[model samples]
Target: MTFTLATWNINSVRLREGLVAKLLGEEAPDVLCLQECKSPVEKIPLEQFAALGYRHIVARGQKGYNGVAILSKTPLEDVDGRDFAGLNHARHVAARLENGVVIHNCYVPAGGDIPDREANVKFGQKLDYLSEMRDHFRAQRPHKAILVGDLNIAPREDDVWNHKALLKIVSHTPVEVAALAETQEAGRWVDITRQDIPSGNLYSWWSYRSPDWDAADKGRRLDHIWATPDISGAAHSSRVLRAARGWEQPSDHAPVFATFDL
Candidate 1:
């Protein structure tokens, strides 16, 4: 069966409920994974999404902070969110579909502006978070899994608009990139989006600091969809919905999508 799965860091589900509805109507992805929902699970505005035919959902949320969710048109079985211990943040949620495809959604912490861990507590947390993630997946050894979310690090040179210029930047820093790579290797995750669109300049996030983001085009591939090697061959047709970044009051990040023949 071929189906489309999309990941977007909506920034704030409550703020972009309308855009979410719009995306559901327009893109019609079979499964949608969202990060940075910034709303409690109980206040996720499920009714609006339910109206769009996504009747099933599994999420971990907190008020005005990090949250992750999976909305599916197909039925889902909730997977325990406690897989990664010690890193207790509303950063992950997972579900197994009726077809036995497991979807793991996550929102990795954005290491702050400063690259120095000692100078920035957030940067330290980000590194520790990724370390814990690497250990957890290494132990579990996922198979046939689809991992999606705003991973918050742009690992590839092509993933950032000006790689040289952004090398020292938080997301493009060597340390951050190495940490992200370790996690990917541990999980045996194939970056489906990059696997499909392997050439020049791919990005899912633009900083709000830029006045003319589109014209300046300073963006980063912060969001991602990675599948296990077992299901990697099933992945195809990936794209970043760049226009969503131009939508009124849109989130800094846009949706990235991929299709799979499961």
Candidate 2:
């Protein structure tokens, strides 16, 4: 089977339901995973997506923060979600395709401005969350799984526009990067996007602080698509939909895509 999957942090799905429809109409990936939906599960505007043929959805959501959803054109089973780090935030959801491929949609906390855990509780939470993820994966171990999300950390130097300058920044800090690396290692997950495009200053997120985001082009590759080693070789055609960042009233993030031939 051949399928294309896309992941994006929509910021708020309800506020940008039209944009979601537009994407479903234009790109139409077999499955689309969303993070930071910022809505309750019952409140998500599902009819529109269903109208676009994405009828299958499994999501975990909160009132106005941290949410994740998986919308699929294909049938999905084993609908599951977990609250990592004991934060009780709706930050993750998982479902299984007919092909036995389990897709995990996640939204890691965007640690606050201060990179220091002592100064910022959110920063500590981010580290603790990642540590828990590593422990969980290390204990259970995953196979035939694809994990995608706005991981909130740019692990590679090339992932940020100015790596040295952003080292102290929350998302590009050395500690966050090392923690994320440990989580990936625990799961035996391969960075499919980097595996496909090994060398490039690729980015999926641009700060709204930039007056001219496109021209300044100071962006970070915060979103990611990863697959376990067993199925990693089946993945290809990884790319970021940079143009989506310029869409009308768009989120700071753009969609990341990868096609898998399994």
Candidate 3:
């Protein structure tokens, strides 16, 4: 089977459910994974999505806070969500397709403005969450799996507009970057985005604070898509729907896409 997948930080799925519908109408990926839904599972506006042929959904949500969901055009079985770091946040969810491929969607905590773990409790939690991810993947090696989400870390120099300038910032900081790397290594996951794009100032997220985000173009590749090496070769057409960021009242982060033939 061949299918296209997209991952996005919708920020607040309910607030921007229309944007989600618009994307589903236009881009029409087979599967869409969303983070920061900020609504209880029962409260997610699924009727609208269901009318558009996205009849299957698996989600973990928290009222007015972190949440994640996966909507698929085809039938899929829920693989449940994990509370990484025991944070009790709806930060992760997984599903399995009939073809046997597993999809893991995650929303890593955004470490606060202060990067120092000692100075910020959120920063410490971020590190601990990543450590648990690394340990989990190390113990249970993944195969024929694709992991996607707003990981909230930009690991590569080219992932941000100004690497040096943002190094001290939360997302591009070396400590967070290293932790993400370790997790990826533990899973033996191939970064499907970088593998296809290879190089360039690739970005999926722009700060909402920027008055003219498009003109300034100070963005970071905080979202990601990764697949296990065994089936990584089947993945292609990696891209970021940059124009989505320009939509009216849009999410700061745009959608990232990849296709796989398995």
What number of clashing residue pairs does each candidate have, in the order they appear?
Answer: 0, 0, 0
Q: All candidates' lDDT scores?
A: 0.92, 0.95, 0.97
Ranking by TM-score: 3, 2, 1
Q: What TM-scores do the predictions have?
A: 0.98, 0.99, 0.99
| lDDT for position 103 in model 2 | 95
Worst 10 residues of 2 by lDDT: 76-85
Which 10 consecutive residues of model 3 have the lowest summed lDDT? Answer: 74-83
Q: 108-164 in candidate 1: lDDT tens per residue?
A: 889889999999988998898899889989999999899999999999999999999
What's the distance in Å from true for residue 123, model 1? 0.5
* Winner by lDDT: 3
TM-score of 3: 0.99
Native-to-model Cα distance after best TM-score fit, residue 54 in candidate 1, in Å: 0.6
Whole-structure CA lDDT of model 3: 0.97
The alpha-carbon lDDT assigned to residue 105 of candidate 1 equals: 94
lDDT of 2 by residue, 8-38 (tens): 9999999999989999999999999999999
Model 2 error, position 59 (Å): 0.3
The sequence of per-residue lDDT tens digits that candidate 3 reaches over residues 1-262 is 9999999999999999999999999999999999999999999999999999999999999999999999999998998689999999999999998899999999999989999999999999999999999999999999899999999999999999998899899999999999999999999999999999999999999999999999999999999999999999999999999999999999999999999999
